[model samples]
Target: MNLSDRQSKLLFGGLVVGLTAVGVYLTVAAPDDEPERSKPRSVVTTGPTAPVAPPPGIATPVSPDSFDVYRLLPFSQQEFATAADLAQRFTAAYGTFRFDEEPRAYADRLAGMVTEQLGGELQRSAAAPGLQEERRAQQIVATGTATLDRVRDIENNSIIFLVTGKQQVTKAGKRSDDSKQYAVTVARDGGSLKVYAFEPADAGQEGDTG
Candidate 1:
């Protein structure tokens, strides 16, 4: 409709105020966007989600087996085996003797396996005139065999074995077996194993020939 400028301006201003009131009322009355429907509330999980039932009559292991006590010892497995072998050989050498072998050679075979002090004793015992003469007259030829009975004791760097030394003697075409038990000590000697000391099982006094 044709109207004056002042009337038109008044009408435009009233329209603007009415629209602003309506916008504010609509904004306050409208609810939120339904909180996005909570997205069905999915959760992620991993690894052994449930307690697994073991098989019937099977026991659950308390824990994995640990290391052996022997592994904690100071010596290596090879060293221990070497020491044991040395002990057995030493006992065998102690009783084995050839009829034609010299006293020095016989003693040397055993002396080399023993400590210096023990070796000296063995050398003296082997070189005895009377013992050598008797052996020669009897024509004795002995072959020795050894077996370990038990471990008598253990030290930091040594082990004592209860050994039975068996000797098969042939004299004048007659054969006989002789067995004796001794406590044999094997110890470390300058990066090698040697017979430290040995005695009869009863620890009795030994003759000069021991």
Candidate 2:
């Protein structure tokens, strides 16, 4: 939470990038007579899914990958899926680490997966004494999983996903679980997806505490 001025600006910028894309997609892609939510909450959830009414433009329910909006976006269907997957993968890596590794060593796990700016912020956070001290004392070794809860935002070349990261921490033979929601932004890096920003949801990806 103690982010530097530069890191704060990076995260805030990512938060705003999606609104324009959302507006563009909604205006240009919809030919339906009625307007309905394009991406329902169930589009990505952690629990059982019930049948959802298809959006106004689509006559029938479609699988996530088969959604019609992908064709309307600057990015392709494959790229969207790949971006979502990268967001989840980044969340998992962010939560997983060993007690013995130095803080920088922990940050290295995220290399190549994040932008240079966000990567630096993560490294700095990982090195926070309060966060690392307890882990080292407890000899914690964490393994985690990330569930994409929903798409928070999108642009021509980026997607921000709301993800829940659950980590099982094993400390001195005892295991416990913890989870947190994050606004995870993945943007196009050359030809591949890379995480451009990550922050706890409470930080308000929308500028609150950015």
Candidate 3:
């Protein structure tokens, strides 16, 4: 049987509405294209930093016991050793004069050594009449104590020492003594040690040079 024109038009309208509803439902149920929201990102930072280092050309400090003025001469150990040997020789010469019976001979020998080691000024000073009398009476004894006080590398090579004690003297069967503090400066002279200066600090006239 053939349908009427109005009924056929109504059927076509209903089919179009059903298709629209099915398209909407499929769009809502489809899976998403983007990744999962719970996953962590994979990013990297810059490379590790380098370590710090000390500067160059810095010198380490020296010990105090290693300081010696004579050692400073020529700035070498060999030169200082030579100066030390010479200092010992001078000590021997002065010691002989200090304990000799013939004071004049002792004075002559000491004057020669002083002139050679210290110069003409010291020689003249040793020859003074008053000084000669003191020598004859054995009023002084040239003695020293060598010690290494401190060694510092910050300031040019430097050393500190203390020479303290007394000199014994005998006059007319009576003995007397004197106490003095002496600081001796040392330097190297042509592979030998020479005393540059003797600074007297605390000097007290007690009695003798013994």
Candidate 4:
């Protein structure tokens, strides 16, 4: 071939080669350009939360030692001592007296003490006919023993105690005696202990016997 014809033929061959190279590069690089296969978007979800607990309530524990008797009676140490003293005085005052004596002074003292310790109920019970006969005929002696069985906190500044004891009566010349159980409910009134209730388990026992 002549020089011009040969040069043109060589240029055409070079162009074809370049076109093939570009096609191969595009096929290989197209897949790589596609957004990197996103590791399937992980969704981190948390579990359900736990429930919250409530606070506790106030607690009051009763004593088993004197629980039964204490429930029936409610008196404090000082009040019980005073009741016992008054009972002794009553015994001494009417120990050997005839039933006709009024027992006014003795009853007055008891009334006052009852008002202080047990309020009106005990005083009225003492004034009952049946109780009067027991006091006179049996020469009843009132003895008291005070015990702190248990202290229960009823409130921040208040407490209830389980208290229990005995009261007895005997005939003037007889050695045999009859006794009954008593209970006192005591509460803190301001700074001092007060008897909220005083109950005799056998107030009518004397009448029952006769």
Candidate 5:
């Protein structure tokens, strides 16, 4: 059937509170005295967001070709590679959004990479009428970076990761940035890693885009 039908099968609301909490971390800065004026774009699409060059010294997956090969030895080579890949994609999907477009379209673009439940939640959140108005009024668009900080637990069925990233907000043309760290958990679903839950990373607490 249709995508919405598929997602309806997975409907649940237990994580709404937690997800809203995560969204709260996306703080908006006070508008600058001379807010940079940005030309309004006519459309928005789901194509890959402009690539964000990872900052220096950020944690990343140990490359198979690098000297740090031993760092990835604890997990099976295949699982480590898959988890790393998922972490990156999840970051890209979750971190990128365009305020000029319809929210459902944005959520639709992210659907394939996430679980049905999450996809539905995203769609509902995006479809909220006030969301678009708020973005338009604020004249802001945000792009985020997701970096894999550490793999805390790996099991046959799931993986836990600590992720950190920068959320860059461009408002009325001027840009401001903030850093967020999260504990993420993902499970293997049909050979792909899909995020199950996420929370702010505390000084000690630990845990992807899809």
Candidate 6:
């Protein structure tokens, strides 16, 4: 069920309704939830040069071999920092789910980072009793490590992060772990970059530990 990059893009038009959890132990995820969104933070880079957004009508170039969309294109430093910061915040918020916390509370925490469609998905899947029951019975807890694997511009105002991370699931006294890669898509909403889709790279594929 691994979705190719083309298929992933199709989801932008509301083509997909549910997404697999990838390596996450919780499979029940996808419900509608909304929380107040915070304003996007301003980007400040080193040096006295003030960064400004690119003007309209200019096409941002793409790199076929790398994720550095701004590498050859003329882009302000602020854009780089903004994309990086957004990716960091989304990863932090996404990887912090706890079994002991209430699902609604968790959804609230992520409301600002995700789009409404994604929020609903999160609430539904997180609130599932089956997932809760399994976690409770196994004393399972999960943690994730997100790394910026690559970055590329999607549309003029959006960026996609090729993120690599490790998900560690501890059940009872034993732990099982796997490393996974995901493409987290973000688009500019007002002044903030909001996540619209969270899809794993090579979806439906599993990693092997050596």
TM-score of each: 0.63, 0.62, 0.40, 0.36, 0.56, 0.57
CA lDDT, every model vs. true structure: 0.84, 0.86, 0.50, 0.49, 0.72, 0.72
lDDT score for residue 54 of model 1: 75
Candidate 3 residues 1-210, lDDT tens each? 787999999989999999999998788865453467656788887998775454566454445887566554434666444434444444445433343334455556655333355655555555677867866675444543232222222113322223443545455456666555444455534444455544453334356465
Q: How are the candidates ranked when ordered by TM-score, highest leading?
A: 1, 2, 6, 5, 3, 4
Question: RMSD of each candidate?
Answer: 19.3, 35.8, 15.0, 17.4, 43.6, 39.7
Question: Model 1, stretches more than 4 Å misplaced?
Answer: 1-66, 205-210
Per model, how many backbone clashes are there? 0, 0, 15, 8, 5, 9
Q: What TM-score number comes out for model 5?
A: 0.56
Once model 4 is optimally superposed onto the true structure by TM-score, how far is the C-alpha of residue 186 displaced, in angstroms?
2.2
Tens-digit lDDT string for candidate 6 (1-210)? 899888788875453333333423243332223233544567878778665656687565343776664565433457766766666677756766666878899889889888888999998888899988887788777776778877745567677888776778788879888677778887777766688788877665568443
Instruction: Point out the higher-scoring one by TM-score: 2 or 4.
Output: 2
Best candidate (score: TM-score) = 1
Could you give candidate 2's per-residue lDDT for residues 94-172 as a string of tens digits? 9899888898887788987999889899899889989789888989999989999998877877888999999999998
* Winner on lDDT (2 vs 3): 2
- Assess candidate 4 and give its lDDT: 0.49
The 10-residue segment of model 5 with minimum total lDDT is 26-35
* Per-residue error (Å), model 1, residue 103: 1.1
Give the per-residue lDDT of model 5 (tens digit) for 55-163. 7986764445765653545456676777776765676567678779778788877777677887798788877888778789888788888888898777667777888
Task: Quickly count the clashes in candidate 4.
Answer: 8
